[model samples]
Target: MQALKEAQKTVVSNAPSAIFPANLDVEYVISFRYANGGQPAQTGDSSTPEEQLEKLLHTLDLAGLRTVVRDGGDGTLLIFTRIRSEKKLLGEIYRSRVRDWLHGIRPAAPEKETQQSIEKEPLTDGERLRLVYSLITLPNSEGGAGITPKQGEWNLVQSIFALHDHDFNKKWLKDWSTKWLIGPEDLKVIRDRFGEKIAFYFAFIQWYFIALTVPAAIGLFAYLFLPAYSSFFAICNCLWSVLFVEYWKRQEIDLAVQWGVRHCSTVQRKRAEFQFDAEATDPVTGEKIRYFPAYRRLMRQLIQVPFALVAATCLAAIIAGVFSIEIFLVEVYNGPLKMILKFLPTVLLSVFIPIVSTILTNFATRLTEFENYENQDSYEAALTQKIFILNFITGYFPLFLTAFVYVPFGEILVPYLDVLNVTVQHFGHDEKYTTSDTGFQINPSRLKAQMIYFVVTAQVVGFVLETILPQVKRTVFKKAKEFDSRRKGIDTQTVLDPPEEKKFLERVRHESELEVYDVTVDLREMCMQVSIFKRWEV
Candidate 1:
């Protein structure tokens, strides 16, 4: 039994990427080693992951049990290590084996024994084309279907557990669609990574911009004639932006039609994405409910209200502190410190805003757990809503206050010779206080200041918050995991524990997972830019 395990371990540990899939429903042979230590040969699994790798080792008999996967068993393991190459090998095995079976199943003529029979087989171009086309068009009768090979057959063959991956998506991706978006390709990854909501967002955006001309026009007009303060243009732009957003919402449904996603009957009748509550996988479909309706997602959304408030509080507090200091130094202070004080508000606000904002965002992240979204949509909707709130408050709120307040309040409150009480010495002559409404003009530099704040200061802030911070955090977390997993790697006591030669494997599973949220972020960032004409005007 021990020797069998040792051999099983060896066979699995070094299984080619062409053997079986991660979601093994059918098992195919992998490699055969003559118990006498002869050269090994590889085969494929036409069955599932269990039937194939779990088949008791070097001795074909049931000499021992080897776990095909580890932890949750949704994936495959070689020996005790969770290597993912088995799926690719399995896919190749499935294809080659199935193709051979198909060839055998096709009725063929016995070897032509006589000249008379060989002469009767004269083939014309038209007949050859018709026969060849018919043969190519036929399906595998055993499974009632054949694998649809696409351009990336080599890549697909490496994913032996393709069916499992597909099945996983087939079950979960359906329910996940409504609250989020999805596409034919992403259906599987969405089920695994962020769930349905995030996936649905992708599907929706892809579906949304099938006609992109309309929004482009509105943006162009806003660039051309719409002065920054034009009430008509402001109303039009705001209304238009909102209308486009709303229209896209409806368009998603219409699109859900042309692209095939509107009604979620599949998700509705299905299981939630994560069901820690369920005892075992279901019998009929062998899958638990992996999703739910938007109402539950909305329930999760309630958590965002406080998050927004907290973000607003943090943002306002930081900006107000800076504003107060700037106003006191510029307007009230008469010390020679005027020049030095000019930079104070910006410097202090820069530090305070990020610190406060970071704390609030952490608090907001904790709150997202309460969102209880079945798929990525409800989850991401709540997530992005918080993100948008942060963007708006940190980006727009300070400018709004500064634009209206600094001049208006300063003009009213600052000491000025009142026109009604002009000095007798100057009564006959025109008199004006340099501090009066007319002289206390809007700083021509204020617009430039605002723009600089965003372009330089705020941009640095954005990079820290979004890109640098997250990357640093990930690197730290990944290093910590590597250290811990190291000890686990050394602790195995079974025969499979012994060292064996390893072949080259190119990538890690799930490393290149696709995302729709990333796309949305890019588009929104582009929109946030000062339009081209606005920049040129500057």
Candidate 2:
């Protein structure tokens, strides 16, 4: 506790000046735990925590980022960072825009007077944050600080994340909540704040929501006015789907052009983890570049075939076993504790699927790393594909079984569940439980119930878990922290910041602890929703 107080005093003494300039705005934070008692030092590297911190600061300085260190509380340190030279950052942004123009990513070329043009348009918050992230995380060879958090030399570096603008976030959320449908300006705001990757996700979701309206109305009409299994409805559904896909392609292109990020995938930086087998010079730029043989990568990628097979087989077997047990309990069994036992399959499924999925996801990640794509985009794309496969199996396989196998050929399968009943009877010395005497009848409504659960119930539960629960947890944790601080007589009011700068510094510290938002997770969820909708329609 005494050491912590001293550390707080040291932080206050070293805090940057009161008048923080716009150029010095804290865009990113690098956090790491202190290597104190009971915390083992990085293996084979015996540097003390202060020495490691100094080295990291030196690296950031060399990378042209201004950094200020603060005590992050609870044995952690936070390094707040921004571009040191506004002029240099502007030049980098200008060069990036020019490259985009040259590659046909941007519709218009940047003006020849670079600085003047940059001043005219200025860098959006998203553009600045993206470039700063690249500066910090890209390899040294790519002109970045070469600090890969939680990897290699920076093993103690826990995270690197950007600070969120609370004011902007409040306004943005309120605006979105108030609007029934987001317009072009809303999308432009998203692009300026969160970059094109995240903006594209919202754009796709909005497009999908609007397109769904037509089919929804048609389905309603069919339900009210048409005969069961109407051919006209089916034909119209198919046609609408075809037209939606075709038009979305054009919409995607237009959004890309408007955002000035079309064809931006071509300009990806080399992955720091990429291993090169050879070196080559670019034909146009004559710059030395790393090369990995296509055939070698192809051989490594072949391993994915066996991996996918194993993953599918394992997950399918589990789901099938659970599904069978559930069927026997619900529809066939007439044993002791029958009502309570019916929930056992759900419990087993809830426990096992996540454990298995996590194991498979980790394996997929390792496999992706083994494949060693040259760029970040390619690496992420490969991993996303593998994960999507896993998601598809876990998400849809049970539904498929219920719809096709259970409903169509359930009579044959239910009698076979007698084997499970016999096994249970043998173990527990219960009465003979067999489907032959139970007068079992398959519930056709089961499939519809499961569909509704996935389409509506699961989505609502997921939203509450993803959005509401996190906020609640954060609030509780924060209040507890404050209470603990008060109990300890830490006096954060005085030790952490001067009166003039307290609010800003405290905001930075709070933002430092917040989780880094990954747009990929949201994108994956959207993809899963689309896949589920298509399967349900079929």
Specify the highest-lDDT model's number: 2
**Per-model CA lDDT versus the true structure:** 0.42, 0.77
lDDT of 2 at 456: 88
Q: Give per-residue CA lDDT, model 2, range 246-274, as digits (tens).
A: 89899999998887777888898887777
Candidate 1 TM-score to native: 0.41
Give the distance in Å from residue 79's predicted Cα in candidate 1 to where it truly belongs.
Answer: 12
Model 1 scores worst on lDDT over the 10 consecutive residues at 148-157
Error of 1 at 63 (Å): 24
Residue 112 in model 1: shift from native, Å? 41
Each candidate's clash count: 52, 0
| TM-score of every candidate | 0.41, 0.85
